[model samples]
Target chain A: EPEVTQTPSHQVTQMGQEVILRCVPISNHLYFYWYRQILGQKVEFLVSFYNNEISEKSEIFDDQFSVERPDGSNFTLKIRSTKLEDSAMYFCASSEAQLEAFFGQGTRLTVV
Target chain B: AQSVAQPEDQVNVAEGNPLTVKCTYSVSGNPYLFWYVQYPNRGLQFLLKYITGDNLVKGSYGFEAEFNKSQTSFHLKKPSALVSDSALYFCAVRDMQRGNKLVFGAGTILRVKS
Candidate 1:
């Protein structure tokens, strides 16, 4: 079965440095999303993208966060300055019509 | 706003015994409920969902969930638990007429022991 793929399974970045997480959703998927789960915490929604633009975002998706669908296959989440609290597992998901979604393995980000 | 609540932090059941993980949801309009499972160091895997029609929804791995509109809940159940079923499970909800983002509950850790 086709799966969502994320790059840089793990990342270590210095505090206040910029970081970008990349994901390649299923080819035929029309809706994409980004969610984060702090260690031992619930999964929190970040943002949703459709038609190459942001459709909706949660309060957790603040000014420092940005998402882009630069190409037909690549979707990216960029953080201008990493904070210690930002350390978590970031997941990328995609859905064909919003009924069921498939999530990527996730990218573990560590900020020090 | 839409949200899901999983009351139990962990549920322990012997192998071959029945198991149920409770889930309650709050959503405006019609609720689209879902169940997902996660293995160690893995992403969330879709198990089943309740959009409409029958209240009983069957999913992968012999798992099923019943959607109760009156109680605003969708609970996952399994007839006979297995050791392999030991994992973290999550309940999520979305409004059918609303957007695509899904609100997930904290999670329930199910341990099927032998």
Candidate 2:
């Protein structure tokens, strides 16, 4: 089965540095999303993208965070300045519509 | 605002026994509920979803959920559990009027012991 794929299974970045997480969603998917889960915490929604633009975002998705569909197949999330609290597992997901979404294995972001 | 509540933080069941993970939700409009499982060091895997039809929704891996509108609950159930079923389970909800973003519960750790 086709699945969302994320690169760099793990990443460690210095505080105040930038980091980019990449994801290739299923080819036919129309909606893409980014969510993060802090250790021992609930999965929190960050942002959703559709039609090459942000459809919606949560409070946690502040100015420091940005998402882009750099190409037809690549969706990337960039954090301009990483903070210690940014350490978490970042998941990329895509869906045909607003229905079931398939998730990627996740990129573990560690900011020291 | 939409929210999901997984009442139990953890549930323990023996292999071959039936298991149920409780989930209750609160939404403003018609709710779309989903159940996802996460194994250690893995992402959330879709298990089942309740959109419109039958209240009882069957999903992958022999898992099923019953959607109760009145009770505002969608509980995940599995008959004859296996050790492989042990993992972290999450219940999520999305209100049709609130857009497609899913609101997930804190998650429940299911331990199916052999």
Q: Which stretches of candidate 1 lie over 4 Å from their true place?
A: B96-98
Question: Which 10-residue window of candidate 2 chain B scores lowest in summed lDDT?
Answer: B94-103
**On residues B20-103, what C-alpha lDDT tens digit does candidate 1 reach at each position?**
999998988878889999888889999999988999999999999999989988999999999999999999986444348888
lDDT (tens digit, per residue) of candidate 1 on A1-112:
9999998899999999999999999999999999999874688889988888888888889999999998789999999899999999999999976588899999999999
DockQ leader: 1
RMSD of each: 1.2, 1.1
Q: What are the per-candidate TM-scores when only chain A is compared?
A: 0.97, 0.98
Clash pairs for candidate 1: none
Number of backbone-clashing residue pairs for each candidate, in the order shown: 0, 0
Candidate 2 TM-score for chain A: 0.98
Show model 2 residue runs off by greater than 4 Å: none
lDDT of 2 by residue, A1-112 (tens): 8999999999999999999999999999898899999985699999988888888899999999999997699999999999999999999999877598889999999999
Model 1 chain B lowest lDDT segment of ten = B94-103
